[model samples]
Target chain A: MVLALSGAAQTLDSTGRATTLGLLGRIDPRARLIATLLFACVVVASHWIPTLLIALAASCTAMVFAQLPIASTLKRMAAMDSFIIFILILLPFTMPGEAMFTVFGFPASWEGLWRAVEIGLKANAVVLMLMALVGTMEAVTLGHALHHLKVPERLVHLLLFTVRYIEVLYEEHVRLKQAMKARGFKARNSLHTYRSYGYLLGMMLVRAMERSERILDAMKCRGFTGRIPLLGRYEYTKRDTVFAALMGALLMILIGTEIYHAV
Target chain B: MHIVDGALSNPVVVTGAVLAVGGVAYGLKKLPMEKIPAAGVLSAAFFVASLIHVPIGPSSVHLIMNGLAGLILGWAAFPALFVGLLLQAAFFGFGGVTVLGINTVNIALPAVLAYLVCIKGVRSSNLTTATVWGGVCGALSIALTTLFVAISLAMTGEEFIPAAKFVFFAHIPVLVIEGLLSAVAVYFLRLVKPEVLGAFEEVKR
Candidate 1:
C-alpha cells in the first residue's frame, strides 16, 4: 500500500516538475511535439556510434538550454534506462561472438557489448529528447497541442480526463486500503483473501461510477458540449522555424549515415 | 510488462501502431456519450491498480487488471488501456512514448480476448460458476499478455528469444494472482451492482 501511494506521489512530483517554465517550455508546444517525434525516429534509425553520440550530445545540449533541473532529470533518465542496463549486463554473457574478456567467470563478447551500447545510446537519446521537449510543457498545454495537431478528439479528451482525475482515484484507493486495514484485513494466499480484495476493487468501481454520474451531470449543466475547446493558441515564429530546421538537418544526417552503411 | 522504446524493430512498431489506431477508432465509435467520463475514471483506476505491487515468493508483481478492464469495458478496453499507458509514459516513463502503440496492442488485445472468452460465464446464474469463469478471464488475460510480449520481443531478433522466455516464466505467479483477484471482483460486483456489466452490452449489440 505504501509502495503504491509513493509511486503515485513520485509520478505526480516528476510530472509537476516538468510543468514549470523552461527554455523548451517557451517554444510553441506543437513545434516541440513534432520535433520530439522526429527526434525519436532519428534515434531509432541511426545505429552508427558517432551519429548516436551526436544525437546524445544534441539532447544534452537541449536539456542544458532548457535550464531543466539537471539532477532530477538525470535521475529520472537513470530510472528509465535501468532495464536496458540490466539487459546490457546480461547480453555479453549470453550472446555468441568473439570474446572480449571474462567477467566473474563468464565469457563476455564484443558483439553483445556493442549491441548493448548502441541500444543504450538510442534509448537515452529518445528519452532525453522527450524530457527536454514534451516534458517541459504542462499537461493541458500538451493536450491542446494534440488537439491542434488533429489527433482524434476522443483520445485527446481521454488523455486529459485521465490526467485530471488520476490523483483523485489514487486518494480513493488509499482510503479504501486504509478502511481494509482498519478492519484487520490481511491478504493471504487463499480464496477468502482473494474475495476480500475483490470486494475492495468492486467497491472502488461502484464509487467511481457514482462519481462519474455527478461529474457528467455537472458538465452538462454548465453547457459543456461534446467538445472541449482548446484555449492555447500558437503562432509560427523564427524560433519555431529555427528549431525545426536544426532538427530536420540532424535527422537527415542520421538517416544518411544509416543509408551509407547499408549500401 | 510494458515494452520500452528502442526495444522493437520498425516493422513491428509500425504494424502495432496501425492496428492500435484501428482499435481505438472502433472503441470510440462504440462508446456512448454519457459513458465518456466513466472511461476516464476507469482509465485512472487501471493506472492506479498497476501501481500496487503484490509480493509473491521472491519478487513482487504489480496489478495489471487488464482482465478486469476488458470484462467491464469490452471493445472500449482499447481506449481505456490506451489512456492508462499514455499516462504511464508521460508521467512516470514506465513505458516509452514511441512504443505506446505496440504496448497498447499487446496489453489491450488480450483484455478483449478475456472479455470474449469469459463474459458468458461471468454473467451466468450460478455464483460459483460465475466466480470461476471470472478467475479464468483474469488468468487468461495475463497469459495472453505475456505471450504477446514474448512474440513482439522474438520478432525483433532471434537474440531476444531468451528474454522473451524469461518474461513468460517470470509472470507465472502473476497469472494465478490476477485470476483469483478478478474472480473475487466479478463475484462481488455481481452481488452489489450487476448493472455495471451492462457497460459492454452495447458493444455486443
Candidate 2:
C-alpha cells in the first residue's frame, strides 16, 4: 500500500509535465468537471441494469479518450473496491428477500445481491469518469478551474498550496524513513515500532512547520497580497462545445433509460 | 473510511454535503491569509503521513491521523482534510467524487471535535498531562469518525446495520495504534517545539 501510494504521488508529479497531451486534454476543464458531475448524479440515480451497464461503458470510453493507462487505472479501482467489499459481501445476507443460498445458517438474498451490484457499478463508473475527465488535468489547473467555477478564493489558494507542497513533504517523509532504516530500525507489530513512527511523524511535522515559516517570510518579502493569482486562461473552444454536447446527449440517454425503466 | 457515491441515500448525501460546506466555510473564515502557508504545508504533511502503512497483526492499515491534524490546525483541519480527500479522489481514485461531501464530513467533523476537546489539555504546562490528552484526542477522533461512518451507512438502510457494526469493531486496533502514536508524537512536539502545538492560537492572534 505504501508503495502504491508513492506511485500515486509520482504520477501526480508527472501529471504537471504531462498536461494537454491526451484526447480530452483539449477540452475545457470546467466543461469536463460539470459534465462529470452530471454524469455521476444521473448514473447514481439510475437503478436499471441496462442504464448502469451503459454508464460503465461510457466511463471506460472516457478513460480511453483520456489515454489513461487502462490496466493501472483499473487496478486502482480494484484497490478501492477492496475497501467496500466487506460491506458488499454482507449486504446479500442482511437484506430480506428471496434467498439465493445459505451460508452458515445465514441466507443471502437476490435483492440484496442486486443492491450490491448497483452500488459497485455506480461507484466505479463515477470514479472512472472523474479520473478521465477532471483528474487528467494538472492539479494546479484543477484548482484554477475550481476558482473560475466560483469556488472560494481562499479554498482555491489552499488547494493550490497543498498541490504545490505534497511532493516536497512526501520526499521529506521518505528521507526520514531512510534515515531510520539506516539506524537499523524496522517496522513491526510492537510498541517500539509505533513510537518510532510517531517520533518520525513528529519530526516531519516540526520540519514542515519551519519550512512553512520560511515560505511565508519569502512570500511576504515578495509582497504577496494573500491571494495567489490564477493565471491559467482556459478558452472554451469548438472542441469543448462538441464534447459537452456529446456528454449532454449521453447523460440525457441515461436519464431517459432510468425514466423509461421507471415508467 | 470513504463512503462511495450511490451507496448512501440521497438525503444522507445531501445532508452531509450541507454540513461539510458549513464546516469548510467556517474553517476558511477562521483561517487568516498569513496562516495559509502554514496550514497548507501541514495539510500536505498529514497527507503524506496518511500514506504510511503501519503493521497490524497480519495486514496493515494506513494512518488517518485526523487527531494530530485537529490539534495543529483546529477549525482549519476541515478544509485541509477536505483538500486531501479531493486530491485522493482525483489522483488515486481512493474515493468517489459525488460522495466527497460525506467522506469529508466523516473525517473532518471528528477532527474538529478533537480540536475542541483536547486543545487546552494539549497546551497544558505539564508534559505528561498533555501527552495523555493527545492520546485521548487521537483515539477519540478515530472513534468518532468510525461512529459517524457507521451512522452514515446504517442510516441508508436497515441491511447496512451489520456492516456498520463491523466497520466500527474492525477499527478497534487502529484506534489504539493511533492513540499511542499520537501520544508519542505529541510528546516529541512538546519537547522539540512546543509552539507547533499551539499553531491555531498564533494564527488567531
Candidate 3:
C-alpha cells in the first residue's frame, strides 16, 4: 500500500539519474536481457555475500570500464533518489526495532535504522548494476533473450512498440502540462488540484488511446502480424555458462553467510 | 500502484503469473468475435486511464478504471486489465509480474461491482441522480479495490500492514476523483458515444 502509492506519479521515466560508473562495450539486446537476468539473480543471491561481493566487484569493474562520471551519477541520485531516501529515513523511525539514539526528538532504533540502510544500499546497488547494463546493451539483443526465455511473442512486440512510443507519450505529457499551465493552472498545492489533474488525465487517456488505436491500425495495414524480429540469440558457449555457474557458486556462499548471521 | 520486478517474493510472483494468464485465457474464451474490438478499445481505455494523473498532496494522480471496466466488461476486464497491467509492468514497472493478478483482481472486482450498481441503481430518471449514483458506485468500487489490495498484502505479510492500511486511506481522494470521472466519462459517452457506452448492454443500458 505505502510502496505502491508512494511510487505515485513519479514512475521510471522521471528517474534520469546519471550513472557514476560506465562500462565500455556496446551491449546488444541479448546482452541487456542477460544482464537483467543476472541483475535479478544477484539481488536474490544477497542471501550470500560471496555472490554479492563478486557481483559488487563486477559492478565496480563494469563501472570503471563504462567511464561513468561521478558528478553526473550524483546528479541522477539527487533528483530522483529522494523518495528512496524518504523511505530509508521513515523506516528507522517507524519500523519496530531497538532504540539506538534520540535525534532531536525522535528515537532512532538500531534494528530498524540498519535494516532501512541495508534496504537502501541494496536498492542503490541494483540501480547501479542496471545502469551499467541498460545503456551498454542494445534493446534488440535483450528482446531476443526474452524470446528464448519464453515470454509471449505478441507481448514482446507490444513491449518493443511501447519502448519506442514511451518517449512520444512523455513528449505528449509535457505538451499537455504546458498547455494546462498556459491555461492558468495555478498549482495551488492542494488536493483540489487533484480534480483538475484527474480531468486532464482522463482527457489525456482518451487522446492517447485514440492515437494508439490509429497506430495499431496502421501497423495492421502494413502486414503487422504482432510479431517483431527484435533480436538474434547469442549462443551461450562455455564462456557464458561458466561465468553464470561461477556467479551461482558465489551466491550460494553469500546466502550461507546471511543464514549464519540470522542464526 | 506499480510494483517492481523483485519487490514481491518469488512465490507471489509465480502465483500471480499463473492466475493472470488463466484469468485472461478464460476471459478470452468467453468473448465473441464481434466483442473483440470493443474489448480492445476498453483495454486501451483502461491503459490510458493510468497515464493521467490527478494532483494530490504534492504529486499528481490518474484514473485507474478497473472498476468502470469490470462494470462494462464484467469478467473480461480480468484479461483486459491483466494485459494492460502486464504492459505497465514491462514499460512502467508500476507493479511486478508477481503482483499482476493481485492488482488485476483488486481493480477489476470493483469494476464488476460498478457494473452491478449501474444496472440496479443507475437507472433513475433524474440526470443528476443517475450521475450521482454512477459517481458513488465509481468511488465505492475504487475504494473497495484499494481495500481488497491492502487486505491481500496484509494477508501475505510480504508487505507491511501499514502499507495496506494506507492504501484505503490514500484512496479517499481517488474515490472522489474516480467517482466524478466515471460519471463524467459516462456522461460524455452519453452525449457523444452513447452507442459505444451502450455497446456494453450486458452490463448497463
Candidate 4:
C-alpha cells in the first residue's frame, strides 16, 4: 500500500506535464474557465438521465479534444467515485419508493436507485468537463486566467504562490519519507507509528516555515511591493470564439432539453 | 470530505459559496504582504501532508490536519485551505467544480474554529499542555467537519439522512488518528522551534 501511495504521489508530480497539445489546449484559458463553470452549473441543474448522459458524453469529447490521457483520466474519475460509492449504495436502501429488490431483508427502491445514478452521472460529467477544460492548463496559467477573470488580486497571488511551491514541498516530503524508510520505519496501527508520522509532519512544517523566511527576504530584496505582477497576456483568438460559441450552443441544448423534459 | 457537485441542493450550494467568499476575503484581509509567502508555503506544506496515509486495522486514511493548519494559520486557514481544495479539485478531481464553495466551507470553517477554540491552549508554554490542546483541536475539527458534511447532505434531501449519519460514524477512527498525530506533531514543533506557533500572534499584535 505504501508503494502504491508513493506511485500515486509520483503521478501527482507529473501534473505539470499536462501539455497544451490539443484543440482545447489552444483555446484561451479565460474562455475555457468560464465555459467550464457554465458547464458545471448547467450539468448540476440537469435532472434527466438522458440529458446527463449527453452531458457526460460532451465532457468525454472535451477530454478527447484536450488530448488528455484516456485511461488515467478515467481512473482519476473512478477514484473520486470510490469516495461516494458508499453513500450512493446506501441511497437505494434508505430512500422511500417502490421496492426494486431485497438485499439482506431490506427493500431497495427504484426511485432511490435512479437518484443515485443521477448523482453519479452529474458528478462525473461536471468533473470530467472541469478536468478537461481547466486541469489541462498549467497551474500558473490557471492562476493568470483567474487573475484575468477578476478573481481578487490577493487570492490569485495566494494561488500562484501555493502552486509554485506544491511540487517543491512534495519533493521534500518524498525525501523525508525515504529517510524514514531507510531508518526501518514501518507504519502500523500503533501509537509509536502515529507519533513518528507526527514528528515527520512537524519537521516538514518547520522546514517550510524556515524556507518561507528566506523567500520573504529574497522577494523583499527584489522589490516585491505587496504584489507579484502577472506577466502573461491572453488574447481571444478565432479559435476561442469558435470554442465559446460551441460551448454556448451545447449548454443551450442541455438547458433546452431539461426544460423540454420539465414542461 | 468533499461534497461533490449536484449532491447539494441549490440553496445549500449558494449559501456555502457566499459564506466561503466571506471567509476567504476575511482571511486575505488578515494576511499582510510580508506574510503571503509564509502562508503560501505553509499552505503548500499542508497540501503535501494531506497525501500521507496512516494505517488503521485493514485500511488507511489520508491526513486532513486542518486542525494543525488552524493552529498555525489562524483566520488565514480559510484561503490557504481553500487554495488546497481548489488545486485538489482541478488537478486530482477529488472534488468537483460547482460544489467547490461548500467543500471549502465544510473543511475550512472547522479549521478556523479550531484556531479560535484551541489557539490559547496551543500557545501554552508547557509542552504537554500544548500537545493535549493540539489533539483536541485536531479531533474537534474533524468532528465538526463530519457534522457539516452530514448537514449538507441531509439538507439536500430526506433520502440522504441515513447516508449522512453513516458519514459521521465512519470517521470516528479517523478523528482519533488525526488527534494523536496532531498532538505529537505539536509536541515536536514546540520542542524544535516555538516561534512557528507564536508567529500568528506576533502578526496579530
**Model number with the top DockQ:** 2
lDDT by residue (B1-205, candidate 1, tens digit) is 8777777899999999998999989988888766788788878778878877665655566799898899888988999898887666654556776788999999999999899888889899999999999899999999999999999988988777777888888788889999988988898889988777647558443
The model with the greater lDDT, 3 or 4, is 4
lDDT of each: 0.79, 0.90, 0.55, 0.89
For each of the candidates, the C-alpha root-mean-square deviation to the true structure, in angstroms, is: 3.8, 2.3, 7.3, 3.2
Model 2 off-target regions past 4 Å? A1-18, B202-205
A1-263 per-residue lDDT for model 2 (tens digits): 13332211224344344336567877898998899889888988889988999999999999898887788889989999999999999999999999999999999999999999999999999999988987777777788889889999999999888888898988889889999999999988988999999999999999999999999999999999798877877787899889988998999899989899899
Candidate 2 vs candidate 3: the lDDT winner is 2
State in Å the error of residue B61, model 2. Answer: 0.8
Error of 4 at A104 (Å): 2.8
Output the better candidate (2/4) by TM-score. Answer: 2
DockQ, 0 to 1 scale, candidate 3? 0.21
Candidate 4, residues B69-165, lDDT tens digits: the string is 9989888999999999998888888899889999999999999898899888988978789999999999999999999999999999899999999
Q: lDDT of model 4 at residue A1? A: 14
* TM-score per candidate, chains pooled: 0.89, 0.96, 0.66, 0.95
* Cα error of candidate 2 at position B76, Å: 0.2
Candidate 3, residue B39: the lDDT equals 59
Task: For candidate 2, write residues B44-157 as lDDT tens digits.
Answer: 999999899999998899999999999999999999999999989988898887789999999999999998999999889999999999999999999999999999999999
- Give RMSD (Å) of candidate 1 vs. truth: 3.8
